[model samples]
Each structure stands twice: as C-alpha cells, then as structure tokens.
Target: MSVNLYRFGKTVVTIILKPLFRIQTIGTESFPKDGGVLICANHIDNLDPPVVGLTSPRVIHFMAKEELFHVPILKQILPTINVFPVKRGMSDKGALKKGLKLLKEGEVLGLFPEGTRSKTGELGKGLAGAGFFALRTNAAVVPCAIIGPYKPFQKLRVVYGKPIDFSQYREQKISPEEATEVIMDEIRKLISAHK
Candidate 1:
C-alpha cells in the first residue's frame, strides 16, 4: 500500500466532508496505537465508510460490497484507498482470507457487522464474520457508531467505543455468533448514547 496515496486520499476526503457534514469524532483514543484491530460499525448509509475513514486515527482497510467495484471509477479508486471487495450474503472465502491476512499483519480493518446497510437506519443483527476474524487473530474489537442522517451541514458523529477484550473468550468455547452479538451490543450502546 502507498502511504503517501492513503494520506492524500484521507486529506481529500477530510476536505470534502468536514465542512459539509461538520463531522465530530469521539473516543478515537480508544483505538490501539499498534497491533491488529477490527473496527465494527453499524451501516446506515453508503457514505459511512468514508465517514469512518476520515475520523479514524489510523489507516483502515475496509471491506466493501463486491458490486461497488463494478463501477468503473470506484474499481480504480477503491483499491488505492485500501478498500477491498467482499461478496456479501454468502460465504466468500477469498474475502475472508484477505481480511484475516490483513489482520495478521497488524492492519486495522473496518467492517459493518450487519453485512449490509440497514434500510430503516436501525441496528441489525451482526453476521459472524467479524467474530471469526477476531477469534482467529485475537485482534482488538472496537465498536463504532455513526449517528445522524446524512443531511448537509448537520452534526455527524462517529463515536468509537472502548476496545473489547476477547482474551477470556479466546480460551473458552464460544461460538462466533455469540461473539458477534457482544460486538453488536456495544455498537447499539454507542448509537443510543450519541443519539
């Protein structure tokens, strides 16, 4: 990955979003300075990824839907911005392996646990992929919430909750589904708190 390119992209995104949305980022200190980390957030709008990207203290490798890559411009731009395509609603082992590899390299990964955007803007049930990655790599799981509609000039808050420790569960017998709920619950709390 090109560090300079990522920085440039971040700068451009910040310039466009900051004044337009008046974005507010909270609890960014909760992100670990090093090591593999999984950032799980609730998905409401298509803009959520860039919103999280601009506010994040570290570079985030986000998993986007495969369809987005089909767009000519996005196909060229997404990879340059550290966005990888993930096939949703089915088992896409290639994407899963890519995410796992990134995590193992101590990269921060951004994912929406719900698998897709919510039509009602309500938090939905989390899929197990995030939990599986967390368990496999033992990465720090940070629950994030993006609060507010995407209206121009409105206050858009991207709140990051404390890192959830999976050390205990790592040693025990726990299903990925159960672990996912733990992540979702924290995200739910963040949305409620910020709203």
Candidate 2:
C-alpha cells in the first residue's frame, strides 16, 4: 500500500548526487509500482549504493556493512540515506529480519549479490542471501547491472533487468541457499552481459 521512501535519502540523493553523475537507468519500468523488491547488484566502488540510488528514480533502501554505520557523519546520514547495517560473515539474523520487514512494508531493498566488492572491479561471486530474502518474503526480485569502472564524472550505464517471479522456487520450497543461487544466477546473467 505504501513505498517507504527514507527521509534523508530523498534529500541527499537529490542534493549530493543528481548533478554529478551521468547515470543511465535501464528497465526501471520493469519494477512493480508497489511491492517488495530485492535489487541485487554488483559491488565495485564504495560509491555503488549512491550511484545506484541516484540512477533510479525510485528510492531504494540498502543494508550496509556494520563498519560503515560506525562512522559519525555517515552513521547519522546512512540511515537517512535509507541505508541500514548488516554484520558480514555468518548469518546476520538482525539484518535479514530488518530486510524482510522493509520488504513487507513495501520498500525496495538493495543488495550486492556479489557480497563483497570485486578487487578488480569485475563481477565476483554472488551470495544467495538476497535470493533467500526474496523467497522468504515472497518479494519480486529485480536484477540490476551497472557497467563502468567506479570513477566520478564518468558516464555509466546502470542496467535494470526485468523483475523475475521467484514463484517457482517458492512452489518448490527450496532451501534458502538454493533459492539464493537461483536469484543470484539471474543477476549473474545480467552482469555477464555487461562484462
């Protein structure tokens, strides 16, 4: 019924980023006008989230690493940026729950299926966590691909792939890891095209 747009994210996105990047967003129309969506993307630059956010006309919420949440200014602004924290390694129950809650509330949550940044800025191995969330929450999965080295003033193409139904996996009641793989693989195919 509602799309959760963060208070700070709206302002920061418009003010800090809109003028700087030549962001080309593809397939945004594919996203459901109102529903939970997991936006799984590749991680290369620290700027990935904002770049993705600005490129998107819709507001996207992200589960950031605990490390980034500790920084003072970022700590305050991150949450406003619609960014929340997640502990890496092992299962972060808190983060997962929060992500689910956001989705159930009709928020678009962003995730790096790659889990970590690519040292060489290429597509890396994707963690199935995002897919797990999709299956568990019964949310649509939007696979996005961003092509361009992480550099400012550089024109880049952020390709938003079609929103795929994970209903098949849901019907099978597959394991979370298994479901995650299916979701990540879709994201991988999108990434492969750009790479």
Off by over 4 Å in 1: none
Candidate 2 per-residue lDDT, tens place, 1-195, comes to 123445455567657654565666677777778878788888877778877887665678888889988898888767655778888888899999899999998878899977788888767767768767978886778888877764566667788888877888789888877776776677678767765
After superposing candidate 2, which stretches have Cα over 4 Å from the reference?
1-21
In the predicted model 2, the residue pairs found to clash are none
Error of 1 at 139 (Å): 0.9
Residue 165, model 2, lDDT: 79
Error of 1 at 152 (Å): 1.2
- Each prediction's RMSD to truth: 1.0, 2.9
Task: Quote the lDDT for 148 in model 2.
Answer: 72
lDDT of each: 0.91, 0.77
- Model 2: what TM-score? 0.86
Q: Candidate 1 residues 68-129, lDDT tens each? A: 99999989988988999998879999999999999999999999999988999999999999
TM-score of each: 0.97, 0.86
Best by TM-score: 1
